[model samples]
Target: MFVLSSPSGTGKTTIARRLLAEDADIALSVSVTTRPMRPGEVEGRDYFFTDRAKFEAMVEAGEFLEWAEVFGNLYGTPKSYIKAGLKEGRDFLFDVDWQGTQQLHQRMETDVVRVFLLPPSIAELDRRLRGRGTDSAEVIAGRMARAQAEISHWDSYDYVAINDDMEQCFTRVKTILAAERLRRARQTGLVDFTRELMR
Candidate 1:
Protein backbone atom coordinates (compact mmCIF):
# COMPACT_ATOMS: atom_id res chain seq x y z
CA MET A 1 0.00 0.00 0.00
CA PHE A 2 1.33 3.39 -1.09
CA VAL A 3 -0.36 6.53 0.13
CA LEU A 4 -0.28 10.04 -1.33
CA SER A 5 -1.84 12.68 0.88
CA SER A 6 -2.02 16.48 0.75
CA PRO A 7 -4.39 19.39 0.94
CA SER A 8 -7.05 19.76 -1.70
CA GLY A 9 -5.14 22.03 -4.07
CA THR A 10 -1.67 20.51 -3.62
CA GLY A 11 -1.70 18.33 -6.79
CA LYS A 12 -1.76 14.90 -5.10
CA THR A 13 -4.54 13.69 -7.38
CA THR A 14 -2.73 14.96 -10.50
CA ILE A 15 0.48 13.19 -9.51
CA ALA A 16 -1.41 9.99 -8.58
CA ARG A 17 -3.10 9.87 -11.99
CA ARG A 18 0.20 10.30 -13.80
CA LEU A 19 1.88 7.60 -11.69
CA LEU A 20 -0.93 5.11 -12.32
CA ALA A 21 -0.81 5.81 -16.05
CA GLU A 22 2.93 5.25 -16.26
CA ASP A 23 3.35 2.40 -13.75
CA ALA A 24 1.80 -0.95 -14.65
CA ASP A 25 2.59 -2.50 -11.29
CA ILE A 26 0.40 -0.29 -9.13
CA ALA A 27 -3.38 0.03 -9.22
CA LEU A 28 -5.51 2.59 -7.39
CA SER A 29 -7.46 1.40 -4.36
CA VAL A 30 -11.10 2.15 -4.98
CA SER A 31 -12.66 3.14 -1.67
CA VAL A 32 -16.20 2.56 -0.51
CA THR A 33 -18.00 5.84 0.11
CA THR A 34 -21.35 7.14 1.27
CA ARG A 35 -20.94 10.28 -0.78
CA PRO A 36 -22.96 10.67 -3.94
CA MET A 37 -21.09 9.91 -7.15
CA ARG A 38 -20.34 12.87 -9.30
CA PRO A 39 -20.35 12.90 -13.08
CA GLY A 40 -17.67 10.88 -14.93
CA GLU A 41 -17.18 8.47 -12.01
CA VAL A 42 -17.76 4.72 -12.44
CA GLU A 43 -19.18 2.57 -9.64
CA GLY A 44 -16.26 0.22 -8.97
CA ARG A 45 -13.52 2.15 -10.74
CA ASP A 46 -13.75 5.39 -8.82
CA TYR A 47 -15.58 4.20 -5.70
CA PHE A 48 -18.02 1.70 -4.38
CA PHE A 49 -20.96 3.97 -3.74
CA THR A 50 -23.39 2.97 -1.06
CA ASP A 51 -26.06 4.43 1.19
CA ARG A 52 -25.26 5.60 4.72
CA ALA A 53 -26.97 2.61 6.25
CA LYS A 54 -25.07 0.09 4.17
CA PHE A 55 -21.83 1.88 4.93
CA GLU A 56 -22.54 1.79 8.64
CA ALA A 57 -23.40 -1.88 8.36
CA MET A 58 -20.06 -2.54 6.69
CA VAL A 59 -18.35 -0.76 9.55
CA GLU A 60 -20.19 -2.86 12.11
CA ALA A 61 -19.06 -6.02 10.32
CA GLY A 62 -15.41 -4.83 10.42
CA GLU A 63 -15.08 -4.92 6.64
CA PHE A 64 -12.76 -1.94 6.43
CA LEU A 65 -9.00 -1.89 6.82
CA GLU A 66 -9.34 1.80 7.66
CA TRP A 67 -12.39 4.02 7.71
CA ALA A 68 -13.14 7.67 8.39
CA GLU A 69 -15.73 10.40 8.12
CA VAL A 70 -14.70 13.37 6.04
CA PHE A 71 -16.75 16.44 5.32
CA GLY A 72 -19.87 14.60 6.43
CA ASN A 73 -19.30 11.55 4.19
CA LEU A 74 -18.11 8.12 5.22
CA TYR A 75 -15.23 6.47 3.35
CA GLY A 76 -13.49 3.15 3.96
CA THR A 77 -11.00 0.75 2.44
CA PRO A 78 -12.25 -2.82 2.14
CA LYS A 79 -9.72 -5.25 3.64
CA SER A 80 -10.72 -8.20 1.46
CA TYR A 81 -9.89 -6.35 -1.76
CA ILE A 82 -6.44 -5.23 -0.63
CA LYS A 83 -5.50 -8.51 1.13
CA ALA A 84 -6.00 -10.54 -2.05
CA GLY A 85 -4.04 -8.07 -4.16
CA LEU A 86 -1.12 -7.94 -1.73
CA LYS A 87 -0.89 -11.75 -1.62
CA GLU A 88 -0.51 -11.69 -5.41
CA GLY A 89 2.43 -9.27 -5.10
CA ARG A 90 0.50 -6.36 -6.50
CA ASP A 91 0.92 -2.72 -5.43
CA PHE A 92 -1.98 -0.49 -4.42
CA LEU A 93 -2.03 3.30 -4.53
CA PHE A 94 -4.11 5.23 -2.02
CA ASP A 95 -5.24 8.83 -2.41
CA VAL A 96 -6.45 9.81 1.02
CA ASP A 97 -6.26 12.60 3.59
CA TRP A 98 -4.15 12.60 6.74
CA GLN A 99 -6.79 10.77 8.75
CA GLY A 100 -6.99 7.90 6.32
CA THR A 101 -3.24 7.75 5.96
CA GLN A 102 -2.79 7.45 9.72
CA GLN A 103 -5.37 4.68 9.90
CA LEU A 104 -3.79 2.76 7.03
CA HIS A 105 -0.32 3.02 8.52
CA GLN A 106 -1.52 1.76 11.89
CA ARG A 107 -3.26 -1.26 10.38
CA MET A 108 -0.56 -2.22 7.83
CA GLU A 109 2.68 -0.65 8.93
CA THR A 110 5.04 -3.00 7.12
CA ASP A 111 3.24 -2.83 3.81
CA VAL A 112 2.35 0.87 3.85
CA VAL A 113 4.56 3.58 2.35
CA ARG A 114 3.32 7.03 3.28
CA VAL A 115 4.17 10.11 1.24
CA PHE A 116 2.95 13.62 1.88
CA LEU A 117 2.88 16.32 -0.80
CA LEU A 118 3.36 19.96 0.08
CA PRO A 119 2.41 23.06 -1.82
CA PRO A 120 5.09 25.64 -2.63
CA SER A 121 3.42 28.01 -0.20
CA ILE A 122 0.05 28.70 1.34
CA ALA A 123 -0.36 31.64 -1.05
CA GLU A 124 0.29 29.37 -4.02
CA LEU A 125 -2.17 26.79 -2.70
CA ASP A 126 -4.84 29.45 -2.36
CA ARG A 127 -4.16 30.62 -5.90
CA ARG A 128 -4.49 27.09 -7.19
CA LEU A 129 -7.79 26.61 -5.41
CA ARG A 130 -9.15 29.88 -6.72
CA GLY A 131 -7.99 29.04 -10.23
CA ARG A 132 -10.22 25.97 -10.22
CA GLY A 133 -13.30 28.27 -9.81
CA THR A 134 -15.51 25.40 -8.79
CA ASP A 135 -15.87 26.44 -5.18
CA SER A 136 -17.47 29.44 -3.56
CA ALA A 137 -15.39 31.96 -1.67
CA GLU A 138 -16.55 30.52 1.62
CA VAL A 139 -15.53 27.03 0.66
CA ILE A 140 -12.14 28.20 -0.53
CA ALA A 141 -11.55 29.94 2.77
CA GLY A 142 -12.41 26.76 4.63
CA ARG A 143 -9.98 24.77 2.51
CA MET A 144 -7.17 27.21 3.11
CA ALA A 145 -7.69 26.92 6.83
CA ARG A 146 -7.75 23.13 6.59
CA ALA A 147 -4.58 23.12 4.48
CA GLN A 148 -2.62 24.67 7.31
CA ALA A 149 -3.82 21.98 9.68
CA GLU A 150 -2.95 19.23 7.23
CA ILE A 151 0.57 20.50 6.59
CA SER A 152 1.31 20.22 10.28
CA HIS A 153 1.25 16.43 9.94
CA TRP A 154 4.00 16.39 7.29
CA ASP A 155 6.55 14.93 9.69
CA SER A 156 4.47 11.77 10.09
CA TYR A 157 4.97 10.64 6.51
CA ASP A 158 7.83 8.44 5.31
CA TYR A 159 8.57 10.83 2.44
CA VAL A 160 7.66 14.43 1.72
CA ALA A 161 7.71 16.07 -1.70
CA ILE A 162 7.25 19.79 -2.19
CA ASN A 163 5.20 20.58 -5.27
CA ASP A 164 7.03 23.69 -6.37
CA ASP A 165 7.24 22.30 -9.91
CA MET A 166 4.86 19.61 -11.09
CA GLU A 167 7.33 17.58 -13.15
CA GLN A 168 10.06 17.70 -10.51
CA CYS A 169 7.61 16.73 -7.79
CA PHE A 170 6.33 13.80 -9.82
CA THR A 171 9.89 12.63 -10.42
CA ARG A 172 10.62 12.73 -6.70
CA VAL A 173 7.52 10.70 -5.91
CA LYS A 174 8.45 8.11 -8.55
CA THR A 175 11.94 7.83 -7.13
CA ILE A 176 10.52 7.11 -3.68
CA LEU A 177 8.30 4.37 -5.05
CA ALA A 178 11.19 2.74 -6.87
CA ALA A 179 13.37 2.73 -3.75
CA GLU A 180 10.61 1.32 -1.56
CA ARG A 181 10.03 -1.51 -4.03
CA LEU A 182 13.71 -2.47 -3.69
CA ARG A 183 13.61 -2.71 0.11
CA ARG A 184 14.93 -6.06 1.38
CA ALA A 185 11.82 -6.93 3.36
CA ARG A 186 9.59 -6.50 0.34
CA GLN A 187 11.66 -8.84 -1.85
CA THR A 188 9.70 -12.03 -1.25
CA GLY A 189 11.74 -14.15 -3.70
CA LEU A 190 15.16 -12.95 -2.56
CA VAL A 191 15.82 -15.78 -0.10
CA ASP A 192 15.10 -18.51 -2.63
CA PHE A 193 17.19 -16.84 -5.31
CA THR A 194 20.15 -16.31 -2.96
CA ARG A 195 19.98 -19.94 -1.77
CA GLU A 196 19.98 -21.23 -5.34
CA LEU A 197 23.00 -19.04 -6.20
CA MET A 198 24.98 -20.48 -3.24
CA ARG A 199 24.18 -24.05 -4.30
Candidate 2:
Protein backbone atom coordinates (compact mmCIF):
# COMPACT_ATOMS: atom_id res chain seq x y z
CA MET A 1 0.00 0.00 0.00
CA PHE A 2 2.96 2.41 -0.18
CA VAL A 3 3.38 3.77 -3.69
CA LEU A 4 6.72 5.55 -4.06
CA SER A 5 7.20 7.22 -7.42
CA SER A 6 10.01 9.26 -8.94
CA PRO A 7 11.47 10.20 -12.26
CA SER A 8 14.17 8.01 -13.87
CA GLY A 9 17.30 9.35 -12.17
CA THR A 10 15.95 10.34 -8.77
CA GLY A 11 17.33 7.36 -6.79
CA LYS A 12 13.91 5.98 -5.90
CA THR A 13 15.12 2.42 -6.24
CA THR A 14 18.05 3.00 -3.92
CA ILE A 15 15.85 4.64 -1.32
CA ALA A 16 13.34 1.80 -1.63
CA ARG A 17 16.01 -0.80 -1.06
CA ARG A 18 17.31 1.01 2.00
CA LEU A 19 13.81 1.29 3.38
CA LEU A 20 13.16 -2.39 2.80
CA ALA A 21 16.42 -3.30 4.43
CA GLU A 22 15.52 -1.32 7.51
CA ASP A 23 11.91 -2.44 7.77
CA ALA A 24 11.04 -6.09 7.50
CA ASP A 25 7.33 -5.31 7.09
CA ILE A 26 7.75 -3.56 3.76
CA ALA A 27 7.90 -5.59 0.54
CA LEU A 28 8.63 -4.28 -2.93
CA SER A 29 6.31 -5.07 -5.82
CA VAL A 30 8.21 -6.24 -8.85
CA SER A 31 6.93 -4.76 -12.07
CA VAL A 32 6.78 -6.65 -15.35
CA THR A 33 8.10 -4.92 -18.40
CA THR A 34 8.83 -5.45 -22.07
CA ARG A 35 12.17 -3.72 -21.67
CA PRO A 36 15.35 -5.71 -21.95
CA MET A 37 17.48 -6.43 -18.88
CA ARG A 38 20.33 -4.14 -17.99
CA PRO A 39 23.74 -5.69 -17.32
CA GLY A 40 23.35 -6.36 -13.61
CA GLU A 41 19.65 -7.14 -13.45
CA VAL A 42 18.17 -10.48 -12.50
CA GLU A 43 15.10 -12.14 -14.02
CA GLY A 44 12.59 -11.63 -11.22
CA ARG A 45 14.46 -9.28 -8.93
CA ASP A 46 14.79 -6.17 -11.06
CA TYR A 47 11.92 -6.79 -13.44
CA PHE A 48 10.08 -9.58 -15.15
CA PHE A 49 11.47 -8.84 -18.58
CA THR A 50 9.46 -10.15 -21.50
CA ASP A 51 8.91 -9.56 -25.16
CA ARG A 52 6.33 -7.22 -26.68
CA ALA A 53 4.08 -10.14 -27.62
CA LYS A 54 4.00 -11.52 -24.09
CA PHE A 55 3.32 -8.08 -22.63
CA GLU A 56 0.44 -7.56 -25.06
CA ALA A 57 -0.95 -10.97 -24.18
CA MET A 58 -0.92 -10.14 -20.50
CA VAL A 59 -2.77 -6.96 -21.29
CA GLU A 60 -5.37 -8.93 -23.21
CA ALA A 61 -5.69 -11.36 -20.31
CA GLY A 62 -6.49 -8.51 -17.91
CA GLU A 63 -3.51 -9.31 -15.74
CA PHE A 64 -2.04 -5.88 -15.07
CA LEU A 65 -3.33 -3.41 -12.53
CA GLU A 66 -1.78 -0.54 -14.49
CA TRP A 67 0.35 -0.33 -17.57
CA ALA A 68 2.01 2.34 -19.67
CA GLU A 69 4.18 2.35 -22.75
CA VAL A 70 7.15 4.68 -22.36
CA PHE A 71 9.66 5.57 -25.05
CA GLY A 72 9.41 2.13 -26.71
CA ASN A 73 8.87 -0.24 -23.77
CA LEU A 74 5.84 -1.33 -21.79
CA TYR A 75 5.83 -1.35 -17.95
CA GLY A 76 3.08 -2.69 -15.75
CA THR A 77 2.22 -3.83 -12.27
CA PRO A 78 0.74 -7.31 -11.81
CA LYS A 79 -2.66 -7.19 -10.14
CA SER A 80 -2.49 -10.53 -8.39
CA TYR A 81 0.70 -9.81 -6.47
CA ILE A 82 -0.54 -6.54 -5.00
CA LYS A 83 -3.80 -8.12 -3.87
CA ALA A 84 -1.92 -10.98 -2.28
CA GLY A 85 0.25 -8.61 -0.30
CA LEU A 86 -2.68 -6.63 1.05
CA LYS A 87 -4.55 -9.81 1.94
CA GLU A 88 -1.57 -10.99 3.95
CA GLY A 89 -1.40 -7.66 5.84
CA ARG A 90 1.91 -6.67 4.31
CA ASP A 91 3.03 -3.26 3.11
CA PHE A 92 4.04 -3.21 -0.55
CA LEU A 93 6.24 -0.61 -2.21
CA PHE A 94 5.86 0.53 -5.78
CA ASP A 95 8.57 2.35 -7.74
CA VAL A 96 6.21 3.59 -10.38
CA ASP A 97 5.25 6.70 -12.32
CA TRP A 98 2.24 8.96 -11.86
CA GLN A 99 0.17 7.08 -14.43
CA GLY A 100 0.51 3.87 -12.45
CA THR A 101 -0.30 5.76 -9.25
CA GLN A 102 -3.49 7.03 -10.87
CA GLN A 103 -4.61 3.51 -11.67
CA LEU A 104 -3.74 2.32 -8.19
CA HIS A 105 -5.57 5.19 -6.52
CA GLN A 106 -8.65 4.44 -8.59
CA ARG A 107 -8.54 0.77 -7.63
CA MET A 108 -7.60 1.07 -3.95
CA GLU A 109 -8.15 4.55 -2.69
CA THR A 110 -8.13 4.10 1.07
CA ASP A 111 -5.32 1.60 1.20
CA VAL A 112 -2.86 3.52 -0.96
CA VAL A 113 -0.22 6.05 0.14
CA ARG A 114 1.73 7.87 -2.55
CA VAL A 115 4.97 9.83 -2.34
CA PHE A 116 6.80 11.76 -5.03
CA LEU A 117 10.56 12.29 -5.08
CA LEU A 118 12.10 15.27 -6.80
CA PRO A 119 15.67 16.19 -7.55
CA PRO A 120 17.02 19.44 -6.10
CA SER A 121 17.24 20.97 -9.56
CA ILE A 122 17.37 20.16 -13.23
CA ALA A 123 21.12 20.54 -13.08
CA GLU A 124 21.30 17.96 -10.28
CA LEU A 125 19.08 15.62 -12.25
CA ASP A 126 21.47 15.81 -15.16
CA ARG A 127 24.39 15.21 -12.84
CA ARG A 128 22.79 12.10 -11.34
CA LEU A 129 21.88 10.73 -14.76
CA ARG A 130 25.36 11.31 -16.05
CA GLY A 131 26.88 9.74 -12.94
CA ARG A 132 25.18 6.48 -13.78
CA GLY A 133 27.05 6.47 -17.11
CA THR A 134 24.77 3.77 -18.39
CA ASP A 135 23.06 5.68 -21.17
CA SER A 136 24.30 7.74 -24.08
CA ALA A 137 24.11 11.53 -24.14
CA GLU A 138 21.04 11.32 -26.41
CA VAL A 139 19.17 8.99 -24.01
CA ILE A 140 20.00 11.21 -21.04
CA ALA A 141 18.59 14.18 -22.92
CA GLY A 142 15.42 12.24 -23.60
CA ARG A 143 15.07 11.36 -19.92
CA MET A 144 15.66 14.96 -18.88
CA ALA A 145 12.97 16.14 -21.27
CA ARG A 146 10.56 13.52 -20.02
CA ALA A 147 11.36 14.43 -16.41
CA GLN A 148 9.74 17.83 -16.78
CA ALA A 149 6.50 16.21 -17.88
CA GLU A 150 6.74 13.68 -15.10
CA ILE A 151 7.40 16.32 -12.46
CA SER A 152 4.43 18.40 -13.53
CA HIS A 153 2.24 15.69 -12.01
CA TRP A 154 3.79 16.06 -8.55
CA ASP A 155 0.69 17.71 -7.16
CA SER A 156 -1.21 14.45 -7.58
CA TYR A 157 0.93 12.77 -4.93
CA ASP A 158 0.29 12.87 -1.19
CA TYR A 159 3.84 13.88 -0.23
CA VAL A 160 6.84 15.26 -2.08
CA ALA A 161 10.46 14.95 -1.01
CA ILE A 162 13.26 16.91 -2.61
CA ASN A 163 16.35 14.79 -2.93
CA ASP A 164 18.83 17.44 -1.91
CA ASP A 165 20.26 15.31 0.88
CA MET A 166 19.78 11.58 0.91
CA GLU A 167 19.55 11.18 4.66
CA GLN A 168 17.07 14.01 5.04
CA CYS A 169 14.96 12.64 2.18
CA PHE A 170 14.97 9.19 3.79
CA THR A 171 13.95 10.63 7.12
CA ARG A 172 11.13 12.56 5.54
CA VAL A 173 9.79 9.49 3.78
CA LYS A 174 10.04 7.43 6.95
CA THR A 175 8.18 10.08 8.89
CA ILE A 176 5.41 10.10 6.30
CA LEU A 177 5.12 6.33 6.44
CA ALA A 178 4.84 6.36 10.22
CA ALA A 179 2.14 9.02 10.16
CA GLU A 180 0.16 7.40 7.32
CA ARG A 181 0.16 4.00 9.00
CA LEU A 182 -1.63 5.62 11.93
CA ARG A 183 -4.30 7.38 9.91
CA ARG A 184 -7.82 7.07 11.32
CA ALA A 185 -9.07 4.79 8.57
CA ARG A 186 -6.06 2.54 8.63
CA GLN A 187 -6.27 2.23 12.40
CA THR A 188 -10.00 1.56 12.57
CA GLY A 189 -9.49 -1.89 14.07
CA LEU A 190 -7.27 -0.49 16.78
CA VAL A 191 -10.27 1.03 18.58
CA ASP A 192 -11.86 -2.38 18.90
CA PHE A 193 -8.64 -3.93 20.17
CA THR A 194 -8.25 -1.29 22.85
CA ARG A 195 -11.93 -1.55 23.86
CA GLU A 196 -11.55 -5.28 24.28
CA LEU A 197 -8.56 -4.74 26.53
CA MET A 198 -10.55 -2.26 28.68
CA ARG A 199 -13.51 -4.64 28.93
Candidate 3:
Protein backbone atom coordinates (compact mmCIF):
# COMPACT_ATOMS: atom_id res chain seq x y z
CA MET A 1 0.00 0.00 0.00
CA PHE A 2 1.43 3.35 -1.08
CA VAL A 3 -0.30 6.21 0.71
CA LEU A 4 -0.22 9.91 -0.08
CA SER A 5 -1.73 12.13 2.59
CA SER A 6 -2.00 15.89 2.98
CA PRO A 7 -4.26 18.66 4.11
CA SER A 8 -6.96 19.77 1.70
CA GLY A 9 -5.78 22.06 -1.15
CA THR A 10 -2.16 20.95 -0.91
CA GLY A 11 -2.26 19.29 -4.38
CA LYS A 12 -1.98 15.69 -3.20
CA THR A 13 -4.81 14.75 -5.53
CA THR A 14 -3.06 16.33 -8.49
CA ILE A 15 0.19 14.54 -7.71
CA ALA A 16 -1.70 11.27 -7.21
CA ARG A 17 -3.41 11.63 -10.58
CA ARG A 18 -0.13 12.20 -12.35
CA LEU A 19 1.48 9.24 -10.61
CA LEU A 20 -1.42 6.97 -11.53
CA ALA A 21 -1.29 8.08 -15.13
CA GLU A 22 2.43 7.46 -15.43
CA ASP A 23 2.82 4.29 -13.40
CA ALA A 24 0.93 1.36 -14.88
CA ASP A 25 2.03 -0.92 -12.05
CA ILE A 26 0.34 1.16 -9.36
CA ALA A 27 -3.48 1.44 -9.18
CA LEU A 28 -5.53 3.78 -7.07
CA SER A 29 -7.53 2.16 -4.28
CA VAL A 30 -11.08 3.44 -4.60
CA SER A 31 -12.42 4.00 -1.13
CA VAL A 32 -16.04 3.73 0.09
CA THR A 33 -17.54 6.94 1.40
CA THR A 34 -20.76 7.99 3.04
CA ARG A 35 -20.31 11.50 1.72
CA PRO A 36 -22.55 12.49 -1.19
CA MET A 37 -20.91 12.15 -4.59
CA ARG A 38 -19.75 15.49 -5.91
CA PRO A 39 -20.05 16.75 -9.49
CA GLY A 40 -17.67 15.07 -11.96
CA GLU A 41 -17.09 12.12 -9.66
CA VAL A 42 -17.94 8.66 -10.98
CA GLU A 43 -19.61 6.08 -8.70
CA GLY A 44 -17.00 3.33 -8.69
CA ARG A 45 -14.14 5.37 -10.05
CA ASP A 46 -14.03 8.06 -7.40
CA TYR A 47 -15.73 6.28 -4.57
CA PHE A 48 -18.33 3.69 -3.70
CA PHE A 49 -21.03 5.97 -2.39
CA THR A 50 -23.15 4.69 0.46
CA ASP A 51 -25.49 5.88 3.19
CA ARG A 52 -24.51 6.16 6.84
CA ALA A 53 -26.54 3.09 7.71
CA LYS A 54 -24.86 0.92 5.08
CA PHE A 55 -21.46 2.23 5.97
CA GLU A 56 -22.05 1.41 9.60
CA ALA A 57 -23.19 -2.07 8.64
CA MET A 58 -20.04 -2.60 6.62
CA VAL A 59 -17.98 -1.58 9.64
CA GLU A 60 -19.92 -3.91 11.89
CA ALA A 61 -19.27 -6.74 9.45
CA GLY A 62 -15.52 -6.09 9.60
CA GLU A 63 -15.32 -5.37 5.90
CA PHE A 64 -12.94 -2.46 6.10
CA LEU A 65 -9.18 -2.59 6.38
CA GLU A 66 -9.28 0.87 7.89
CA TRP A 67 -12.12 3.36 8.37
CA ALA A 68 -12.50 6.87 9.71
CA GLU A 69 -15.01 9.67 9.97
CA VAL A 70 -13.82 12.86 8.32
CA PHE A 71 -15.71 16.13 7.99
CA GLY A 72 -18.89 14.38 9.16
CA ASN A 73 -18.63 11.64 6.52
CA LEU A 74 -17.39 8.08 6.89
CA TYR A 75 -14.66 6.78 4.58
CA GLY A 76 -13.11 3.32 4.48
CA THR A 77 -10.94 0.95 2.49
CA PRO A 78 -12.62 -2.27 1.52
CA LYS A 79 -10.38 -5.07 2.80
CA SER A 80 -11.30 -7.72 0.23
CA TYR A 81 -10.71 -5.53 -2.79
CA ILE A 82 -7.17 -4.64 -1.72
CA LYS A 83 -6.35 -8.17 -0.63
CA ALA A 84 -7.35 -9.56 -4.02
CA GLY A 85 -5.22 -7.00 -5.81
CA LEU A 86 -2.22 -7.74 -3.58
CA LYS A 87 -2.61 -11.45 -4.24
CA GLU A 88 -2.25 -10.70 -7.94
CA GLY A 89 1.05 -8.90 -7.23
CA ARG A 90 -0.46 -5.47 -7.82
CA ASP A 91 0.35 -2.31 -5.90
CA PHE A 92 -2.33 0.08 -4.59
CA LEU A 93 -2.06 3.81 -4.13
CA PHE A 94 -4.02 5.26 -1.23
CA ASP A 95 -5.09 8.88 -1.02
CA VAL A 96 -5.96 9.06 2.63
CA ASP A 97 -5.65 11.24 5.71
CA TRP A 98 -3.33 10.86 8.68
CA GLN A 99 -5.81 8.77 10.63
CA GLY A 100 -6.25 6.35 7.76
CA THR A 101 -2.51 6.19 7.22
CA GLN A 102 -1.97 5.32 10.88
CA GLN A 103 -4.43 2.46 10.72
CA LEU A 104 -2.94 1.09 7.52
CA HIS A 105 0.57 1.23 8.91
CA GLN A 106 -0.48 -0.49 12.11
CA ARG A 107 -2.16 -3.31 10.22
CA MET A 108 0.27 -3.72 7.34
CA GLU A 109 3.48 -2.14 8.55
CA THR A 110 5.89 -3.65 6.07
CA ASP A 111 3.59 -3.24 3.09
CA VAL A 112 2.67 0.41 3.67
CA VAL A 113 4.76 3.30 2.36
CA ARG A 114 3.33 6.48 3.84
CA VAL A 115 4.01 9.85 2.23
CA PHE A 116 2.70 13.17 3.48
CA LEU A 117 2.55 16.38 1.43
CA LEU A 118 2.88 19.80 2.97
CA PRO A 119 1.71 23.15 1.68
CA PRO A 120 4.46 25.68 1.11
CA SER A 121 2.76 28.11 3.45
CA ILE A 122 -0.56 28.79 5.14
CA ALA A 123 -1.10 31.84 2.92
CA GLU A 124 -0.65 29.77 -0.22
CA LEU A 125 -2.97 27.06 1.11
CA ASP A 126 -5.68 29.63 1.72
CA ARG A 127 -5.21 31.03 -1.74
CA ARG A 128 -5.49 27.59 -3.32
CA LEU A 129 -8.62 26.76 -1.34
CA ARG A 130 -10.30 29.99 -2.35
CA GLY A 131 -9.12 29.49 -5.93
CA ARG A 132 -11.20 26.33 -6.10
CA GLY A 133 -14.38 28.49 -5.56
CA THR A 134 -16.28 25.37 -4.63
CA ASP A 135 -16.78 26.12 -0.96
CA SER A 136 -18.23 28.96 1.05
CA ALA A 137 -16.24 31.19 3.37
CA GLU A 138 -17.40 29.24 6.43
CA VAL A 139 -16.45 25.91 4.82
CA ILE A 140 -13.05 27.22 3.88
CA ALA A 141 -12.46 28.39 7.44
CA GLY A 142 -13.32 24.95 8.72
CA ARG A 143 -10.90 23.40 6.23
CA MET A 144 -8.15 25.77 7.23
CA ALA A 145 -8.63 24.82 10.86
CA ARG A 146 -8.56 21.15 9.92
CA ALA A 147 -5.50 21.67 7.76
CA GLN A 148 -3.47 22.89 10.71
CA ALA A 149 -4.50 19.86 12.72
CA GLU A 150 -3.58 17.55 9.82
CA ILE A 151 -0.16 19.12 9.29
CA SER A 152 0.65 18.52 12.96
CA HIS A 153 0.92 14.82 12.23
CA TRP A 154 3.51 15.27 9.51
CA ASP A 155 6.13 13.41 11.50
CA SER A 156 4.14 10.20 11.27
CA TYR A 157 4.76 9.69 7.58
CA ASP A 158 7.66 7.78 6.05
CA TYR A 159 8.31 10.57 3.53
CA VAL A 160 7.30 14.23 3.57
CA ALA A 161 7.31 16.46 0.51
CA ILE A 162 6.63 20.18 0.49
CA ASN A 163 4.52 20.92 -2.57
CA ASP A 164 6.00 24.27 -3.56
CA ASP A 165 5.72 23.43 -7.24
CA MET A 166 3.48 20.72 -8.64
CA GLU A 167 5.91 19.20 -11.09
CA GLN A 168 8.84 19.17 -8.67
CA CYS A 169 6.73 17.75 -5.88
CA PHE A 170 5.42 15.05 -8.22
CA THR A 171 8.95 14.16 -9.24
CA ARG A 172 9.86 13.66 -5.57
CA VAL A 173 6.78 11.56 -4.95
CA LYS A 174 7.57 9.36 -7.95
CA THR A 175 11.13 8.95 -6.76
CA ILE A 176 9.93 7.69 -3.37
CA LEU A 177 7.63 5.21 -5.06
CA ALA A 178 10.39 3.96 -7.32
CA ALA A 179 12.80 3.47 -4.42
CA GLU A 180 10.20 1.75 -2.24
CA ARG A 181 9.32 -0.63 -5.05
CA LEU A 182 12.91 -1.78 -5.15
CA ARG A 183 13.13 -2.61 -1.43
CA ARG A 184 14.60 -6.04 -0.83
CA ALA A 185 11.55 -7.53 0.85
CA ARG A 186 9.33 -6.51 -2.05
CA GLN A 187 11.52 -8.12 -4.72
CA THR A 188 9.49 -11.33 -5.15
CA GLY A 189 11.58 -13.67 -7.30
CA LEU A 190 15.00 -12.63 -6.02
CA VAL A 191 15.65 -15.61 -3.80
CA ASP A 192 14.62 -18.13 -6.41
CA PHE A 193 16.60 -16.41 -9.16
CA THR A 194 19.71 -16.31 -7.01
CA ARG A 195 19.37 -19.99 -6.08
CA GLU A 196 19.02 -20.99 -9.72
CA LEU A 197 22.08 -18.92 -10.65
CA MET A 198 24.14 -20.65 -7.94
CA ARG A 199 23.01 -24.12 -9.20
Instruction: List the lowest-lDDT window of 10 residues for candidate 3.
Output: 126-135
Question: Arrange candidates by lDDT, highest first: which order?
Answer: 1, 3, 2
The most accurate candidate by lDDT is 1
Per-residue lDDT tens digits for candidate 3, residues 1-199, read 9999999889998899999999999999989999999999999899999999999999999999899987799999999989899889899999888889998898888899999999999899999778668889998888788898999999999999999999999999999999998998999989999999999
lDDT of 1 by residue, 100-180 (tens): 889898889899999999999878998987866888999888878888898989999999999999999999999999999
Candidate 2 lDDT score at position 85: 77
Please give the lDDT score at residue 75 for candidate 1.
90
For candidate 3, give the lDDT of residue 26: 95
> Which stretches of candidate 1 lie above 4 Å from their native place?
132-138
The 10 consecutive residues of candidate 1 with the worst lDDT sum are 126-135
C-alpha positional error of residue 24 in candidate 1 after TM-score superposition, expressed in Å: 0.8
The lDDT of model 3 is 0.92
User: Which candidate wins on TM-score?
Assistant: 1
Better of 1 and 2 by lDDT: 1
Error of 2 at 33 (Å): 3.5
Q: Rank the candidates by TM-score, best first.
A: 1, 3, 2
lDDT digits (tens) for residues 115-176 of candidate 2: 99999998898887776688898988887888888898999999999989889999998999
